[model samples]
Target: MNTPILLLQCLFLVLLSGPLFAQRWTTTSQESEQQPLRLHGSLLFQGIYPGFRVGVERPIRQTDFQRSNGRVNSHQRAVLFYVGMYYHPGFHLNTFAGAEYIFRRVGGRGLITEFRSSLALSRTFLGAETYRVGEAGIVETVLASGQFYAMPGLGFGMGKVLGKPGSNRPFAYMVNLNLTGLAPYNGLALPTPTLEIGFRYQLATTSVHFRHRIRTRQ
Candidate 1:
C-alpha cells in the first residue's frame, strides 16, 4: 500500500475513535455528554520549508486556582490530533499524522503556557525518480519511492486568549517550537526542529458553557 493511502486510513481511524477516546475521560453522566472540540490551524516552518497543520483538540480535564491576594488562574489537560505536510522543493515532500497530550496553564491576564508530547507516523516521498540495478544487471524504476518512520516529539508554546473580561472569548493563539525524533535512518536517530504559529477556535459547547471568573485583589 502507498503512504498516501495509509495516511488517509490513519486519519479516518483517528476521527472515528475520537468519541470513544473521550469516553474514558468522563467523570460523571453530565460530563458524558458530547463536549465542544477546538479546531486548530497553523503555519509551519522547518528550516525554511514551509508547511501547514490542522488539528482537532478536546479538553479532558481542567483545574482552577486562586492566589492569596485574590488573583485566579487555571490549568487544563487536553488531547490533540493532527496531520501536516511540507515540501523541501527538489529534495522531498514529507507528510505526518499524530496525536499529542497537552498540558496548558492560563494566567489571570489570559497568558498561556503549554507543553506537549506526541507520536506520529511519517512518510517522506522522493522528489526524483528512483532506479535500482537488479542482480541480473537490468535497471528498474522504483515505484512510489518513499520512506516511513515513527516520529516522537516534545514541544512548548506561549500565547494568549483574545478576550477575557466577559469570559466568553472562544479564540486563542499560540506559537510552538518542537523537537521531533525520527529513527531507523542508517541505524541512527535524527532530530528535526520545527516552529509553528497557530490559532485555536472553539466550536459550539454542550449544554453547560465553559467559563472562568477572575477575582480582583482585595
Candidate 2:
C-alpha cells in the first residue's frame, strides 16, 4: 500500500510539473546564462500525497572564478533551502536543505544537467486515531499524536534557464528523479523514487561577463 502510494505520488508529481517545465523550456534562450541566486516553486510527489514546494538557491562561492564562461561554466555550485506541502490522504509539510551540482550543459539554450542531495524533516497530522496505554491499575485511550519523519535524498535532473522577471537574467526549470528513504515510513522499509519538477528565478548574480572570448575573422 505504501509503495503504491509513493509511486502514484511520483507519477502525479510529474504530471503537475510537466506543464510548467514545458513553459519554461520554450522560453529558454542562448543569451541568458547562469545566475548566482535562484528562487523557485515546484510540485512534489513522493508519498501518498501530491505536494507543492518553493525554494531559494545561491552559489557556494560569491567570487568570480569563471566569469569568462561564455556558453557554459564548468564549476557551478549552490545550496538550496526549501519548504513544501502535501494535500492528500494525510496533510504533510516538509522542510529541507539541499546542495546542487551542475554537471553538464545540454545545449546552447541554457539547458543543463545536474545532481542534488537533500535532508528533510516532515510532519504529518493524523486525524482522529486511538491509542491504548495500560498502566498499573488503569487504561487510557489517547487520540492524535502526530508523526514525524526524516528523509535523506539524492536526485538527477535536467534544467533550462528561463528569462528573469523585469530583467532578462535567468530563470530555470528542472525535472528530477529523486530517491529517498524514510525511517519508519508508515510501516514501510525501502527507498522510494519521487519526481520533482520546478522553476527557479534568479535574484542576484556576481557577474555574467565572460572572462574569456574567442575571436575569429570570417
Candidate 3:
C-alpha cells in the first residue's frame, strides 16, 4: 500500500470513531469523582464486509459514577471515541469513526455487565467482481461502476468484562454481541448481528496511584 493510502486509512478511521470501545464494563463508587483514561482495542467480524476488522477506542471524559439499589455497589457511565479500519486489497477498503456510550453495573459474582451504543459514519470503496461466464468459461463479466457509497450507522450491544473482585485492572478480555443498522443503501438497511472480541486497559491510573501513595512516598 502507498503511504497516502495508509495515512488516509488511519485518518478516516480516526474521524469516524470520535474516540469511542473495545466496548467495556467498569464498576464505580460514588466517592470517586474522576475516573482514569482508558484504552480499548477490538477485532470485529460482521456480515456486511465479510472480514475481520480492528478498532482502537479511548475514553475522553472522566467516567460518571453513582451508587444504586441501596447496595455498596455503583453504576458507571463512559463516553469514548473510536477509529477503525478495513481493507481487502482488490475487494474493498473502509474507514470509520464513532462515539460510544457504556452504562455499566456489577453482575453476579463480580462480572461487569454493560449496555453499549454507538453512531458512526463510513466511506467505502468497492471493486467490481468479475464472474466466469457460461460453460467453457474463459470470458469474464464485470459489474460496471464499481460502487462508492457513504453510510451512517447506529448500533447497540450488550457486553461483559470478567474480573476478580477488588482488582483495579482485573479484566483483560471483553465479549460483546452487537446489532447494527446502516442506512441509505441497497434494500432496507436491516439490522445485522456481529460478535466482537476485544480488550481494555487503563492508560492513566490516577486512582491506583492514590492508593499506592505509601509505596510512592517510600
Candidate achieving the largest TM-score? 1
TM-score of each: 0.75, 0.58, 0.54
Ranking by TM-score: 1, 2, 3
Candidate 2 lDDT by residue in tens digits, 1-54: 699999999999999998775453222222324445578788888665567778
Instruction: Please identify which of the two predictions, 1 or 3, would achieve the higher TM-score against the true structure.
Output: 1
lDDT, residue 94, model 1: 80
Error of 3 at 142 (Å): 15
Ranking by lDDT: 1, 2, 3
- The global Cα lDDT (0 to 1) of model 3 is 0.52
Give Cα-based local distance difference scores for all models.
Answer: 0.78, 0.58, 0.52
- Candidate 1 Cα lDDT to native: 0.78
* Model 2 worst lDDT window (10 residues): 209-218
Better of 2 and 3 by lDDT: 2
Candidate 3, 185: how far from true, in Å?
0.5
Residue 97's lDDT in candidate 3: 68
Candidates 2 and 3, the one with greater TM-score: 2
